[model samples]
Target: MGGVTFTAGGSGEITGATFSSGQTNATVSSATVSFTGAIFHNAVMDSLVVSGNSSLTARNCTFTSNGRRGLYVETIYPQGLVTDCHFRDNQEYPIWIKANCMDMLGAGLQFSGNHYQSIAVSCSAGTDIQRSQSWRGQPVALDLTVGSTSGLTVPAGVTLTVAGPVTALCRRFEVAGTLRVGTGNGYQAWLTGPADTRGSWEGIHVSSGGVLCLTDARLTYATTGVSANGATVTLTGSRIVNSLYDGLSTTSDCTVHLDRSYLRLNGRYGLNLLGRVTGRVQNTELAYNGSHPVYALAANVSCLGSGNLYPSNGRIPVGVSCALEPDLTESATWTAQSVAYDLTVNPYGTVLSIGAGCVLTLSPGTLVRGGGVDVHGCLEALGTAAQPVRFLPLGRQEPGSWEGLYFYPGSTALLRHCQVYYAKVGMAITSAGGYVANSQFRSCSGPGISCAGTANPTFYRCVISDNQGVGVYTRDSAAPNLGNLDSAPTHDDGYNILQNNGQYDFRNESSVSPRAQNNYWGTTDPAVVEARIWDGRDQAGLGRVWYLPLATSPAAAFAAPVTGLIMAGATALQAPGGNVEIRVHLLSPASVSLRVCNVAGRVVCSVPDRLTGGVGERLILWNARSDTGRRLPAGAYLLELTARSPDGPSTRRLVPLVLR
Candidate 1:
């Protein structure tokens, strides 16, 4: 017969084929190839490929120096019987088998010198390797990314040593078994990668929609023990220690829940949160980390209870407050002290109130959480410029964490050089007037300062920026005076800097326009300031904001400088077609524009023109064409622009252009 078929008792020897040209040395398909004692060695492709409905029975076969894979037995029907085979020195997996194959292995199957002789596939009927068998493959580039449809479970007491990085790419990777990295009889799972502070390799990365649940397991010693970007990762009774960077890091709104876990001895922060991520650390031990145990930059981490030790190793970090056992609620005069917990002011009624003349001085880095400071008395929180009292939420410091400092009708608050951020409203005053100087209101979900119901607070030298809503909102005859209300109140003390607010810098809902002069709007142009201030100019049935003699630069304002290109007049433009003359004082290159916008803040016409030359004059002519290429009818329009010098810190003039 052409096919080599040996009886059960018969034996054969096939060897001495030492050629490697990326081709298979031996193949058996759709035929009965039986070798009782075969010896195949030195092949480029797999040493033996058994596929289709082939019946292969090889006893005591020795396969060495296979290039790609040692033995590729594929398909569900084909079966091979290897009693005592020896596989060594393969490039990829030594024994490669596809899914759903009826492969049988007898006792004493030895894998002496191969690189990662492991089987990777999912089984619906389940496969079990007894505790007697072991993996004797050499540890080379054996990085494995598991992608099985069904779950892959390793039974108890079988410690699989992963020499290289092991990632799970399936939808769900459950580990009810144990996975070891280093050879030790310790309780922790040891990873054998280089322990440099920077990083070593790509540790374990879980993709989106992937879930990694580790119950009673451990992973240690990699660049990052576990990194999940927008994945659900939960660890119960597990440990991830001895990592270079963070022991576990999550970003992009990933939900990470850790219960009864230990993340100890990491190089950097034990748990790092980036972006808008949110997680919970319940009864977890985070110890001996270089930086803060929990470092969150614009992220949220909710400490569940008191069992979590924050500074289990080093001192408390500069900004992070220690996790308090229970949320603290106080109302008396709070003096200088380190607030290392979630603190609420006046949680119960006026029982623990801050009475009159009781100065409550908060130390620097005092993080007072929500519950709000309901001041029926007096509060004096005068922090320095470098270190300010930070009011935050229990978990994350995002906007709307808590109610802001509320002042009753007779209460008073003197805040100097303080920061009120991440609150529902930065400060709410009702009929009780106070002094707020050199303070900052940032990142508030509501208005920076809501002055209503006969509240008259004076804000001096304040900088309000990056608020989710308006910077200073007033309603119902609530007039909050800005800048120095001294002898030169109308001339502007020239200090407050408000810019880049979500809505308007000054939103006057009252019937009268408030005086907010001399404050810098991040630009020297009046048109930019008028566009940012939401008053009667933009909305009908509302009061306008009186912002004149605006600051040309930060913290300083001068009378309109007679330099660069200056608009002569904008009111009486020659109907339909006219020349808008601009006078040039200093010789400098400038970008000039005669923009005509309606009351609805829409750009109707723009005369693109530039001015360059000595201190003389320049002219811009407009044909009254709207942005949609149509001739605009003369009704009412806002002509505003800075016909002046190049954009810099220098003072520039904004001439009003009210085309009738």
Candidate 2:
């Protein structure tokens, strides 16, 4: 409706001007021109082209049904910056660029962070389809056919399989370049092949080094889903449902990373990795998929040292690291067999619960056990230091255990000076509880020490190495973090020594606080003391530890008002000894003399049963000595319960000691 044309110059601002398409090109002879709202409806022209020597900044502009490109540029050139722009609903390509329009696009050109929409485009001829193109060079043109054959396309370098039954085909289908399929525009941008002869795209083809990243991209392959020949395909936060063949297939050592993704109602197999194919998966969910959720096999001859796959609580056996991020409600049971060698846990809190005779082992300082550790829902480890706990299988340990640590919920444990290894998840945090000082979980399934929705625990002088998930994770409140108390080493040498781990270990609040002065600490730093090592190990020798049993049982007073003994549930037993001597007395004596015996069961003590009466303050001096005047072993030992009742002598309470 205007008769005159208003032109601005030199770093000009379009104050309150509205530009409508009529008879020309919008030229910014100046270095910069800010447009508030410019509706360009091409009534005749083929393209609404914008040329600028420096920058053409447009904020809230709509270009509908333009003959050609909604906004075309000869070249953004160098030193260009574009932020918060929307390009949509155009006849052809909504936006196009030349060269590395985004990358080192042109010298000083930088794409800090840009969002793109259904901009069906191509950098080069065979760019997306993987006809051998470079990522840093110029942009490829969009013309996907087949092979280096059909020209360039998208979804290159990967494979797929449909789980359910359906039919479709795409003779000209490919995914190339780095496009995040989700962005709420995936459905609008992606191509869904037309109905076919009731058979899905049977085969998959991908070029080398090409990646297909799908974020929130919907794929309904009817008969077959997707297959990756030898491309790095990533399915992130996306979905693939109702397919005849499996959800995915891979070959030629390609990699597939699935994050927070899901695949349901598949046909044959949910997911399969054939011959030497490897993958890394995290936070993904799979349900009702064909026969198995996941099927993976390393090179034929040997299925050992295969690729690594970690799942933070998915469908078990069908996937790797199932118990990883267990939800009390959705936790599943896991098992492992004699894997030839010792199974190792790279992270602490990895779930490893095995049956009897099945040994899970740690090579050395490199072992770790995560959360859930008991099949019965209790946490138990039957290993000691001098012998170091082993989880997988080796010597007396190589036959490998059929079980791994279990993490049920409402469970807790305090383990140290031991190595846990070789299982599904090193230590699965099945229940709610934790540990302290000198414990190590390395080379296991995930984050070594996982924090499932059901558990919250702590660690001291503990080392969680080479795990699958985050070193330490507290995802949502359902997966609440009890608390994280990294108290400074308190022991004389900086290691925490407490049945309670000497420091509160639940990770609550999300923030952490410093520890104090005393004995061993779970999350305490040694630097606070002059005796700390970088590996989170303590330099001090077993530092002093004095535990007291608060349980209401006769043995609770065995160390009679117990002093200098590591306290168990209701018994005051033994701990890593320092220079301190452990003394104890018989609160009540049986019929015979009770002796302190070693593994050999040879009597080490002779506490006569002739005078005591349960918890009755009977004095029985030990002085940390054996019967023949020799020092005892450093670990834990049972206080032999020989009986000499007033009625007669007895041996009944030997197998299971009876407290007074």
Candidate 3:
């Protein structure tokens, strides 16, 4: 069947031993061999006769050049799904949809991030077909190298893998869901808190892979041997000390990146990279590992080493050291060497290049300090289902032990299943996409989850109490403000739950609306409980106007969302349920008239003020009523709350009221 151009048939499986073609019009005789990749050199594939009737399979042969495409021969009926196959070279349009894709001058047919100019549609209805999915903007084509297809629409959740030198910072970071540092010792990662000596403190533990990061943190005495199932771990600008076992460890494969960090006073391996591991060490060093300064198995070691990892002999050569500074006083060179500036590198810096797949884990209970990790490029940390990432501060409930977790902007991930506190700020996000849920924040100078003018950043199912400052503050026009609610309440410094440190008036900005809305006061006081709607009876509203009588007892007296402001339709409309209080004052001597009218234009309550004097302001109060003293129905009603001065016209508002 050189170029026989076969016919279409069934939904059965047709096995083939040998099938090959290098020309066009080569139809798939039966479901025999799907032209997995390319049909042939100049192959003219199928022309879709029926729905699921056309299929050409290529079990074991290969096509190397321009030929018919998978979607070319078959029309887009059976959804053009090609699986468990390979395509080599042969080119076709990227996007080739058949249905409603018209303006496609190869348009909709070739939609992608690359051909976005002609394909990527805008957010407007002119092209906004899918509304539920909020597309950031135009799309770009990164998956173009493999397929010669004309176009492809960028769908949601399409993630791109990044390969790099462990320098680029990302927004998100996750480890197993558990405490680390003080609890799981020897992790090489340290924490800084009170009582630097020892305690029954909990250590860090996770079911699987863990990635540790830091930024402005200080760690102290933790358990021994920090470990990860099989995950990439990172430590930048940090410190680790007083550990008993291996610094960091992993089972499967991983890469350990150390930058501007230090390690001291360890009993076992200073830093251990198991399972074909690679350490990208930059401007960092390891010292005082009682046993092997650095441990590695010759079988699993593929290193592009720097001056770190110590000698292959297992110990730091007793001779080599950082150059010392001298002072010509009493015992000059004996001034004692202090490991200054977080880390003391030798003459220059250290750079380690790794191939790819490696699992470098942490020795349990490793104490780490100094500034935490700072990410800026392509990074992906995927822990196991049972094993979430754990970020534990060293020692007990000591303060200033960690710098908290920092998610550099643009990377899109903050952290999950981790504990951060006792440092400065729990989590600080500058400019990026952040999603931090199921996390904890303990005694820290919060401003918990601080975002400095970023895009929609979310903090969901997070426990943030016992901190010193505000909870979640958003400014600079952000959206999707989710999970600002209190799942559980913790206590600490001033502000209790959450504090809206921004200007939008937490009580108003629609971005954040918690089930149990936590106010910016950060405290869970009666005020927050009371003012769940808003506080105060006389608080000035948008018009800056205050209704007469302001508010009534317990009603206007209760607390509200700390919007730092209050608004109302009628002032005297106190805790208005059934009892309505209205005060009336006569104006121009014509008895001031008042009445609460329902939507049907029926006067539910009527109160006429007596002839009054004085040109100044007058107040009127009303006790919610009906013509027959019967409760009004629960529908729309206008509160004709009115007042009039002897010299002024009566003032009244058609305020809406409900019996809720």
Q: Candidates' lDDT values, in order?
A: 0.56, 0.38, 0.36
For every candidate in turn, the CA RMSD to the true structure comes to 21.7, 23.1, 27.7
Error of 3 at 404 (Å): 2.2
Per-residue lDDT of candidate 2, residues 45-128 (tens digit): 423343445456655555555555555544334224333334444555555543223321221111111123322233344333
- Cα lDDT tens digits for candidate 1, 179-281: 3332222333323233333354445565454555555556666577777776667777777777778888876757778888888888887877553454566
Minimum summed lDDT over a 10-residue window in model 1 is located at 556-565
Better of 1 and 3 by TM-score: 1
Model 3: lDDT to the true structure: 0.36
Model 3 per-residue lDDT tens digits across residues 1-660: 344445554333434322244344344433333443332333444221122334443333333233334223223222223333333444443222221111111111222221111111111111112111211111222121122221222222221111110121111112343121211222322232223442112222222444444432333344443454555555556665655564554555665666665666655655565554555655556676665554443222223133443323234332112122210101001001111111112233111111111112211121222334333321122222233344434345564455665544333343334455676666655554444444456666544555553444444344555556544434343332332323221210112233333221223222322222222233335444344333123243211101111111211101212221011112223343456433221212333456778788877777676234342123454555587977666666666645454444444434444544
Off by over 4 Å in 2: 1-39, 50-56, 60-69, 73-118, 122-124, 128-226, 229-237, 242-244, 256-260, 279-660
- Ordered from best to worst lDDT, the candidate numbers read 1, 2, 3
Error of 1 at 49 (Å): 3.5
Local error of candidate 1 at residue 362 (angstroms): 18
For candidate 1, give the lDDT: 0.56
Best by lDDT: 1
TM-score of each: 0.36, 0.32, 0.27
